[model samples]
Target: MKNIPFISALFTPALIIIILSGCSRIYYAPTTQNVPLLTEQNELRIAAGISGGEEYEAVNIEVAYSPVKYVGIMLNSFHAAENSDSLFTNPVRYKGNLTEAGIGFYYPLATYYTAEVYAGYGKGTAQYPWSFDTIAPLKFDRFFVQFSAGMKRKYFEIALSDRFSYVHYTNIEEMYKIEAFSNYKYVPKNNQLYIFQEPALTMRAGLEAIKFQMQYQICIPFSGPTLGYSSYNFNLGIMLTPSVFFK
Candidate 1:
């Protein structure tokens, strides 16, 4: 929410990268095929893929993998109408989404299906205003953890796949608990926050296409929550994996 303005600032940067990557889309409408995402298994190697689409005039990044089979990760990040930048006069620049990193266990199902015990924390928006952010000083002072159960289909025995998170983030604004976003030298002792409080469910589905020996992923992001100021968000873009690996 507070990051919307900052996220919008990335458009210029993303545009430059898109131009440099030689992958550009006019985006007149939407072109995401409701396609199957799983690839057949064939090797004892690692694979990675990414995808993104455009919504709220912002781009999203999706990442997935088979780094070893038993170990994998998925990530997502976005913003609300709230300002992503501190200097934005509008305070509602644009929606921003970015999935930094997530680690989970991937279970291969039916040689075509995969299940995940996925728990992740990514920034997102409210389907409806809970007035939590406006409630008090506790809004920005706390963080949360969320969990999801998902299914994915293998893609042509490669790094491509599709998955959905039926469960979404909740308990958006523990504003009464937000005593830190302020510049106080001393911190409070009471802290209460929930990953979700349930006004509307934030369901998300994604399709991933891995190409170039799993060097990059093309992902399309779509979400339409039936509650709030930003009822639904649709965005698309690509995610690139740095050659360097940590851990």
Candidate 2:
């Protein structure tokens, strides 16, 4: 599936802003959640939610179906916007979308505890922020592995998850014009491989059909050629899930 454009597109402009603002960060870890809804035979689920922060925002939708007792197939899509600027420049905004599909397995570890694992891949496109004339030629391919454990109570549930991701950006030279970074001495040296890890804690409350969700996440970059990249990204979001499962 295809969709993850806005977050990818924001890279160039965000890089410029960060560099000009006296920092040298070139990577961002998109906000993602891991909530496994394992259904009974022939059951399906549909969920949507909105999430945001000072520099980025997103709308997400997901569909899942369980053909067996503990395994599920899932599909998801997102539209996101990212904005930033140097202290002296007006803010520049970038918008794009992404979609992914994956499979997950869940099992109970204890009376109130469960564990889950899932993986997915997706692609997206966005226009270069300099102008909308040409679509960004950057080729982005992403792969992720996630693990989660949670406890469920009568009306509330708490979950903790870790997501490991690898992303490769191809044909990066297309946007590597020297003029673009003339104002800054340091520029991204490698565009081929980026690695990130995110750990999140989530809580949900309410009945089966309607529930409220909130999450806090921290993103850590493991590998990159960089100077002063944000080691800890403070992130947060909220969501509401309706009709979690259809029997």
Candidate 3:
């Protein structure tokens, strides 16, 4: 739990994908507003991501587009939480890969809502006892698809997100499978199990020279219901983004 503060330092704030076109008016059509849609006209960008706070660490890969009206994809590799016979049982060094492919569309003058759809695929493994035993590790497969409607504003957008995930392995790859509360995702590498191992939320904010995409959020089970953490998955990293902020 001490890592919470360390992760807090990295937790700069909400990620803002600010559309700096600087239109004086708040309500205007994208055609007139000169919006930064993910169309062919956008500058293509590559991105990398790092995540995990007192729980798990994850790496993400994505392609950022400014030219397209609203369309892009994100690929991710989520590491399972490490097991813990001790405070940290060599923390489960598990990896699951996922890909998100979707589109953003709207009416000629509509704002604050866009049609969205996406699909994903992932796989990972761990020892029967959440250890890297020489014996064959247990494996799991996952995939999900959702037809969602997303809100769109210059500052932020909150959407009603609904997603369903599946986990497989007869011997139970995740400890959760062995626990009382049954979660959709495997136990990850950590013995700790919680529902919505990876909950889904959608929001984005912009910083001085960077933009953030709030892909999903998790209420830190360790903390009170109020004191929870969110996961900002699958977005651009500062090191690789182009310097279009000032221009």
Candidate 4:
């Protein structure tokens, strides 16, 4: 009976330490991958939506146009942010944005199927709470190649896409000081490189000109440094093809 009290006393501190150490900070959040099913010239696709998972949310905008036969161009932007309730004594917050542009070729595989390939470059900045009183900002560059194929019907569409990306972190400020927090040990170091394979499934349903869209995506680490990042993403939004309405 006397030993019971001694065991509890020793275990209490260890349990607290474990709980505190388990808290992790997110350094990377994957954005929604845009998939536009273009089949011919003069086709345009515009989409705006909200995407999020686990610890963050984002506003996403995408535009794709086919100006010439089998030639397509696209632009995408994402603004993401997260603010968590206080952990221990301090709150954690993050703000970031990314922009990307790509050019690609698309072709119709069958009556309703289309296939496309694109390569793009992206740049982004992330600002997050590094310490109880300090926030650190980081910049990163990414290059990606994506392949997509889908079926488009009169009132519905479905697509599957896989994107491979290489990300490099730069302009890291105060990375050396991150070691002060034990929980943040998983954060990536300066000049780190990481390769990610992201695959997504997208669906849309509604009228011929406008439709409700949803996407589910997963991010997998392919190589290089690994850290705490959002691995899954869900997006809900609307897609518009103005040309269809006019036709």
TM-score of each: 0.35, 0.73, 0.46, 0.86
TM-score of decoy 3: 0.46
The TM-score that candidate 2 achieves is 0.73
Candidate 1: 10-residue stretch with minimal lDDT: 25-34
Location of the lowest summed lDDT over 10 successive residues in candidate 4: 83-92
- Model 3, span 1-247: residue lDDT tens: 9999878776534221122111111000000001122222344544445544333355555554544545544344344332223422344343333344333332322545555445555554444332345332455454544445556554554454444443333333344433223222223333322222334454555642345654444322321121112332332233233534434
**After superposition, candidate 3 runs with Cα above 4 Å error:** 1-48, 53-55, 64-74, 83-88, 91-109, 127-136, 153-160, 170-199, 207-209, 215-247
Q: How far is candidate 1 from the true structure (C-alpha RMSD, Å)?
A: 15.6
Candidate 2 residue lDDT tens string, 133-194: 43334456678888888987647888898887776655555555521464233332455467
TM-score of 4: 0.86
In terms of lDDT, the poorest run of 10 residues in model 2 is 227-236
Whose TM-score is higher: candidate 2's or candidate 3's? 2
Determine the backbone clash count of candidate 3: 20
Model 2: how far is 148 from its true place, Å? Answer: 0.2
For candidate 4, what is the lDDT?
A: 0.84
Report the backbone clash tally of model 1. 51
Could you list the CA RMSD of all candidates, in the order they appear? 15.6, 10.2, 16.4, 4.4
